[model samples]
Target: MESVRTCVGCRARASRSSLLRVVAIDSALIPDERAAIPGRGAWVHPTLECAETAIRRRAFVRALRVSGSPDAQTLIDHLQRNG
Candidate 1:
């Protein structure tokens, strides 16, 4: 059976494959396409709206359990580039 993950932004449970796995890189959020990055990861949909929502609500830091604010530009840029 496939694993299910929850989206920090939308707060919806979804298949792991349907959500994008993001990890902190230098305190900034980055997409882990292969979901192989180390450390804590926060899941979100591959869309700018979700990314923005996550940032606005500080979901990344809460979900990843990191200190301070985590940058979301890299993830936003990534979603924009690939969108």
Candidate 2:
């Protein structure tokens, strides 16, 4: 069976493949397309609304256990392009 994860933005449970895995690198949110990046990861739907919600709520920092605010523009840009 496929794994399941919760979207930190909408707080909805979904199949792991249906959500995008994001990781923090140097205090920046980076998309983990392969979900192979080592470290804690936060999952979110690959939609601008979900991505923005996650950023607005600072979910990445809390989920990734990172200090301060991690730049979310990269994730936003990524979603925008691929959304």
Candidate 3:
């Protein structure tokens, strides 16, 4: 069976392959396309809407259990280029 995860933006459950896994690295949000990163990861849909929502709502900080604001610009650029 496919693993399931909840999107931090929309708060919806989806198949692991259907969502993107993001990890926090020293206040930077990094997208883990392979989902092989070793750390606490937050799942979000690979869409601008979901990404923006998560950013606007400061979901990444909470989901990743980070101490400060994480730079999501890389994630935005990534989604724009590959989304």
Candidate 4:
């Protein structure tokens, strides 16, 4: 079946294929290119604004069920590379 997920940043719902999956691994936020990584994952658009908003709103940890500040370096780099 087709997968649909809501972006934690903009709270916009989009197909899983269209939205990027950010997974929490080793207490860091890493972009899941194939969306196959196990563990808590949150969906978001591949835009910096959404990322920043998600961070600002403190949505990542909640969405991913992680504690402490998550290292979003990978996610940031991914957005930079895509943008």
Candidate 5:
């Protein structure tokens, strides 16, 4: 059986292996490619639109229960850098 996680943006359930896992660290958003980060994590589809929605809606903050927000550019940068 595949592990399933809910997308913070669209609330869609997806296989954990298929979704991109993002973790908040040092007050910044970091991509957890290994999904081994020991902190609050938010899931999103591996698409720019989903990432944009998550940022625009503050879904990451809500899912992570964080008070402050991370810069969306940082997230896009990370995605670009990693991809």
Candidate 6:
């Protein structure tokens, strides 16, 4: 069976390999290309809407336990560039 992860935006459970994993690094959002980042990570659908919703709602901050330095736009841009 495939590993599963929950999308922080929609709260939908999906295959871990199917969702995109994003991690905050140096106050920037970077794609977890290998899904091996040590810090907290957030999962989202590869679609624009889900990415936008996650940013608009600040889901990453909550899920990742980040505070005062969450870069929502950077994350959105990363998702757009990578999606």
Clashes of each: 0, 0, 0, 0, 0, 0
- Using all chains and alpha carbons, the TM-scores for the candidates as numbered come to 0.94, 0.96, 0.96, 0.93, 0.86, 0.81
Screening candidate 2 with a backbone cut-off below 3 angstroms (N, C-alpha, C), the clashing residue pairs are none
Worst 10 residues of 6 by lDDT: 68-77
Minimum summed lDDT over a 10-residue window in model 5 is located at 74-83
Candidate 6 stretches with Cα past 4 Å from truth are none
Q: Distance (Å) between predicted and true CA of 69, model 3?
A: 1.1
Runs of candidate 1 exceeding 4 Å displacement = none
**What lDDT tens digits, residue by residue, belong to model 3 across residues 1-79?**
9999999999999999999999988788999999999999999999999999999999998888998788888899999
Q: Residue 70: error of model 2 in Å?
A: 0.5
Clashing residue pairs, candidate 3? none
lDDT of 5: 0.82
Q: Taking the tens digit of each residue's C-alpha lDDT, what string does model 2 give over 1-83?
A: 99999999999999999999999999999999999999999999999998889889988889999999898989989998999
Question: What lDDT does the true structure give each of the candidates?
Answer: 0.91, 0.94, 0.93, 0.92, 0.82, 0.78
How do the residues 1-83 of candidate 5 rate in per-residue lDDT, one tens digit apiece?
99999887787999998789988776677778788989889998777778888888999888877778775666788767755
Candidate 6 lDDT by residue in tens digits, 27-73: 66666767898988889887678877887787877777777556666
Candidate 4 CA-lDDT value: 0.92
Deviation from native of the Cα of residue 61 in model 4, angstroms: 0.6
For residues 3-82, write the lDDT of model 1, one tens digit per residue. 99999999999999999999988888889999999989999999899888999999999888888988777898999999
**All candidates in order of lDDT, best leading:** 2, 3, 4, 1, 5, 6
Residue 77 error, candidate 6, Å: 3.3
Candidate 5 Cα RMSD (Å): 1.6
Poorest lDDT segment (10 consecutive residues) of candidate 2: 52-61
Model 4 residue 25 lDDT score: 84
